[model samples]
Target: MRRFYAILVAAGLVYMLFMFLGTIVPYGKADVADRVSAHFLAKDVNSISPTKWVEGDKQVPHSERVYGRKGFEDGSANVVTSIVVNYRSFDTLGEVTVLFASAVGVGLILGGTRRMKYGRKPNFILRVSTGILLPLIILFGIYIFVHGHLTPGGGFPGGTIIAAAVLLLYLSNEEFSLNMIVSKSLEGSMGSLYVIFGLIGLAAGGAFLFNFLPNGVVGSLFSAGVVPLVYMTIGLKVGSELSGVVAEIHEEREG
Candidate 1:
């Protein structure tokens, strides 16, 4: 029976290899730009035109109406930012919830409840080094999250900082144990709140995560309506999930 199984597996592998080769054998390159141009100039080009719905000689506000004013009204200078945080904030909420669930799953699989055998007793030098670096790391994380709109950093970076601080605590103090319940609670609550906030937008207005607040000055710190809010939720959720993972890993190592 074992020999028969081995033969079957070998045959399956050969069959898969043949199928894979067949896909690559007929590899052909097509002119992408030509295809795009053909589509654009097709007989059904009217479907792609933006001015179809506008009636009469009314000047279509393509720049001002669709993006500029609408985007600024929502408080984000970046149209993409406005769309994600305001128009599609529910997706972000769901993403964070998925992360939270993944963290919980990891903790459960790794036996998070198991206590460590050896307490984390860092030497004086290590303790002092961590103490000094902790604040700096935290500050950097905050800087990333706060300036997410203007620059590259964002909630993910900030949350990573918070998790790093917790890690430092775990490393410096042997008796230090993360409050899994608290962390999990916070994660779940924030995730729920994020979704609820988007739902509220739908209830009050017609859109989910619609920017109801005033669209402050474009370049100002408070410009983006729901960008800050959504980013904050992301940071909180990521921090909690990362910390939980760290705690689980620590417990596993100790066990």
Candidate 2:
């Protein structure tokens, strides 16, 4: 009965979504860009005083007027970053929830207390190579998430990269293990921090995950206000979650 109700609720939501979409007038190719997207590209969704968008105007292109525009409302240089982490950040939160759910499901199914194992013992070369490359990989992951607002990479990809480093360690050294205390602690804390930041936004600006912090000059490391901090928490959470998954899989494989 609960499953049936869930299906019913999901079906109703889909119907409502389609109905909402049907009501939206298609802003044609030549029409003044959708105000939401226009503002996103302009990096001024948080603008105290926003100018309304007009026809034949900015759509996807970053105008020189907005390029490196100081005192930006969003302060994120990457347009997609502005959209993903700034404009529709709630969607990004939903994405984090989805990944968390997957990790939980995997843990429930593959949970184990045994040691992680591989098919055969790796040689010294593999172990030494992993040792040499591990720091570099983790460093690159940090770079990716740290520069997320300025570049193409973000928390998800960056965290995955960090988890890849953990995977490398497991493959090269069968006895090597991640400290569960630290891993679980980091994962739980980071996830909680992500939501706490959202709650702070709610308290400060009447919106969850609001960019309440002041926008610094565009194209700078500290420019995107609370965005970089948010990404750092996400990267840590995702890294720990995925590392947990890798541990589970490896432990179950040879257990």
Candidate 3:
């Protein structure tokens, strides 16, 4: 009986997938150039462009978007950003949730406020150099996530970079410790803000994580509406969460 139900669910999913695919191009007609990439490139993600069927070709493909076009489905110059933040933002939310869960699991296993147990004290050169370079690394991480709508980097990488700075501190200073209360507060705030933005979008635009803000120039600092904001939230949340996790695992267990 369980097997029968599983088969039924699988079949239903496959049918839905097929229906989705058929809407992309056309039934029984395949156009390699007119695939999903074309829609992304053309900034036609939110709605289907007009289709003109011909004898040989599957459909008249939508022309790729000219650079810096305004008032499209999304205002991001980076096609990947548009897809990730606007077209399918729910998946990004899931990714953040998974990271949060991992952080929680790590905290559960290595639960303590004990200090790190270093083998030897860090030298002056190592300490001084880190002091000089730490701020730069953290700033670079901020740049990555903030410019994620226009550049290659995004929240995950940016947050990881910031967390790396925290790790560097631990390595350089034996007594360095994070205040869990402050860290947890920042983490919770950022996570809540991410969802709050999504909920606000749903109220205004009838879609969760909708790009609710005004569209600015493509490739500009303030463009892509909620993407930069969302990425910023993700960066802070991830950096704090990972910092907590790293701090936890580094602690000297009170045995």
Candidate 4:
């Protein structure tokens, strides 16, 4: 009976996937083949832009303005970064808030000290290697979040990386402890700063999360105004929250 239900679910999922693909991909393969060939043979990749069949209310197809005017609006070369941090910043804030709240809830639920005894101690090599790698890993995380506007990775992934580093430390040294107050303070400060930035945009006679900061030179380290700052803030908040969660869980498990 279970197997039959599982098969039914799998078939439904496969049918849904096929329907999705059918909607996206037209029945005709000749056009697709021609386009693929043209794309491969095109002299300038920019000239071979993808066609958007969808039209707006004005019967005009929206074009890729990000690539065309990279520096004018937002100085982020990376469209994903610009969209995530600048265009949909308020949404990102909500996402971070949700993550923070979840972490806090879990930490609260699992908050306790119950030390589980393990006979074996961490080896000298593991301890020394973790100590050596910790700072470097943290630096890498900072770099990822800081350069999110120009690169692929952003605050969330970078923060997870930093949290992973903390987890490594916790695993290596049982005596290692996270300062809950400090972590909470940092998290609160970052989240507040995000809101303050939004308010600043509102005060400036623009909508919330308006790009009020001067769009500096494109592709530079300090180009994307408020983007890097926001990402860093998110990184710090996420890192702190996740590290605290880890500490709470670890303590509960081994208190």
lDDT score at residue 176, model 1, on the 0-100 scale? 78
lDDT of each: 0.64, 0.77, 0.77, 0.72
- lDDT per residue as tens, model 4, 1-255: 978855754664465456446556456644553352332222121324554322224221223332333332346756677778876787998999899889879977988776433457977888999989999999999989988988899899899999999889888887788888998889888877777676666546345666778767667888777788888888998988898888787775542
Tens-place lDDT digits, model 2, residues 97-201: 999899989888887787755567798898989989999999999999989898899899999999999999888988877887788889988876877787677
Poorest lDDT segment (10 consecutive residues) of candidate 4 = 36-45
- Listed in order, each prediction's TM-score against the native is 0.66, 0.75, 0.76, 0.71
Model 2 residue 173 lDDT score: 84
- Return the lDDT, model 2, position 184: 81
Q: After superposition, how far is residue 113 of candidate 1 from its true place, in Å?
A: 3.0
- What overall lDDT, based on C-alpha atoms, would model 3 receive against the true structure? 0.77
Clash-forming residue pairs, model 4: 113-255, 114-254, 114-255, 115-254, 115-255, 116-254
| Per-model root-mean-square deviation over C-alphas | 14.0, 8.0, 9.1, 13.1
lDDT of 3 at 189: 82
Q: Which scores better on lDDT, 2 or 4?
A: 2
- lDDT score at residue 203, model 2, on the 0-100 scale: 58
Q: What are the clashing pairs of model 2? A: none
Q: List runs of model 4 lying over 4 Å from the truth.
A: 1-73, 113-119, 253-255
Question: What is the overall TM-score of model 1 with all chains considered together?
Answer: 0.66
Clashes of 2: 0
